[model samples]
Target: MILIANGNASRIGIHTSIGDFAATKDGKTYGPLNTDGAFYNMKMLMFDTKSRPIGILVMEIPATSATSEADAARQAEALRKEVSEKIPDLEWLFQHS
Candidate 1:
């Protein structure tokens, strides 16, 4: 998935693997779904373990702004930590993107 941070120049973008199929956060399943339509309406994205690893690009808009380069780096670190805590096994490749 591709996550684009919305805000100031301090924002960032993240590209990661979707890792599988789609399902609602409440466990309601969607299509073996490609094309984003099945997953677009979701507030939080989740995937089914039954499917093969795949990329489903997504963008996350946060409510905060980082005013400086250092602040941006700190914010990015916090975001990474949050994601790691949520999906410990998932791999993340970070860059200026």
Candidate 2:
């Protein structure tokens, strides 16, 4: 089972690979879309509850070709929709698998 999640630097640390990261309510870190405005898969380091490196969390970056304000908005909305739809199934895997 594949569990989907966002990659970001948590409060205690920072990810050196990518910029524009932020902490989310889900206890995960998220990075901004690349300058190319394309969704890229990232293998992020994950820590267990004890702060040990358990494994890597692979995440999907948002798909965006933001050339202008409207384009960015549309792509962001599309990405949001996609993430929302997949979250339920992914969450199940995260908890069960």
Candidate 3:
């Protein structure tokens, strides 16, 4: 499971249903044809309460590409700090996680 959030709200669930073959947003499915540089590539799948795809949340950092686990942890902490300052609701989430 994954958590997607911002200053306003947050959602948690399996990020995707179809692997990387496609993505869904605002009740619409997007294919590779919708590529727009980092915009499309950075999105994490978001789903509604019924477990249906709703949209996406663009990730701040692609930690998967980090050189090592330590690097990923550092990037995650930095991102948590950056996000918590802007969205206080997520502060606890970061701490508990």
Candidate 4:
């Protein structure tokens, strides 16, 4: 699974190339998506609670994309709707398959 954190997640970590990477696409490793913003920091991470540990990723998302507050609000709402509709199903498939 994937976890997105905006400065709420920070701890000891590890990075290695021993297993699967989610950003790997079309036989090409695009690496991780580094989320960056203005008002706060963002991060993306993968972990298995039952297992000891494997890998970790950190992303910083910026709130600098919007030119104004209203624009930011609108964009945020749109992105929320778009992602909320698809991510859950995608996650279910990922877990089941």
Candidate 5:
């Protein structure tokens, strides 16, 4: 994703992979929640392996733009959906994360 920082003087494009695990209130699983300041703030309940959340995996991508937070959120969600649908081992990674 491309991010414009320092009032557009510094632009950063990042390619990131998933890193951590978290669960939603409803027992759904997702991960690597983008802690990047430009991304939407997503919160999830963290748990240990014994909890074994239901196997749906959602991934968060960092917000892709600096101008519009809403657009960046939409882009991130879309990328998450695309990755979840296209990447076959996403579940395994989610489990391990």
Candidate 6:
């Protein structure tokens, strides 16, 4: 849901056709979500697809001063749990670098 880039800045363009994003689990699907009016004011970090365990869109978000990589990792872990629970055989990956 939220990701932070591990390196330099770069704008990841969200186009009309972001290509094929697959879902590891049956009946499970995902798309590029809208961050237009998000209070967090985060940007699109990375785009991951569900061709494997990684569901495709891995967004890197800036964390609060108190936030740590562990926190981000926990968030990612939680997301994995939620998705896998509902999707059955879902896969995901986070690529900040």
TM-scores for the candidates: 0.28, 0.31, 0.29, 0.31, 0.30, 0.31
Give lDDT tens digits, candidate 2, residues 2-72.
23333532422434332222223243434445567576433334444344444344445446434544444
- RMSD, every candidate, angstroms: 16.1, 10.6, 11.9, 13.7, 11.5, 13.9
Better of 1 and 6 by TM-score: 6
lDDT of 4 by residue, 1-97 (tens): 2433235455223333334354322332122223433532222222333322223333332455655444544454444444444444433424645
Higher-TM-score candidate of 1 and 2: 2
Question: What is the lDDT of every predicted structure here?
Answer: 0.35, 0.42, 0.40, 0.36, 0.39, 0.35
- Model 2 residue 42 CA deviation (Å) reads 19
Residue-level lDDT tens digits of model 3 in 2-96 = 44444545444445345432443333322221233222233334443344433443443343355543454455445434544554342334575
Return the number of clashes found in candidate 1.
Answer: 1
Q: Pick the candidate with the highest lDDT.
A: 2
Q: Give the per-residue lDDT digits (tens) of candidate 6, residues 6-65.
A: 243453333312333333124233222235522221211222333234334343434542
TM-score, cand. 3: 0.29
In model 2, which residue pairs have backbone atoms overlapping below 3 Å?
7-29, 7-30, 8-29, 8-30
Candidate 4: misplaced stretches above 4 Å?
1-37, 40-64, 88-94
TM-score between model 4 and native: 0.31
Model 6, residue 73: C-alpha shift (Å): 1.1
Could you tell me how far off, in angstroms, the CA of residue 71 lies in candidate 6 after the best superposition? 1.6
Count of backbone clashes for each model? 1, 4, 1, 11, 0, 14
Cα TM-score of candidate 5: 0.30
Judge candidate 1 against the unseen true structure and give its global Cα lDDT, from 0 to 1: 0.35
**What tens digits encode model 5's per-residue C-alpha lDDT throughout 26-87?**
54333332555545443233222443332332334355543354554455455545544544
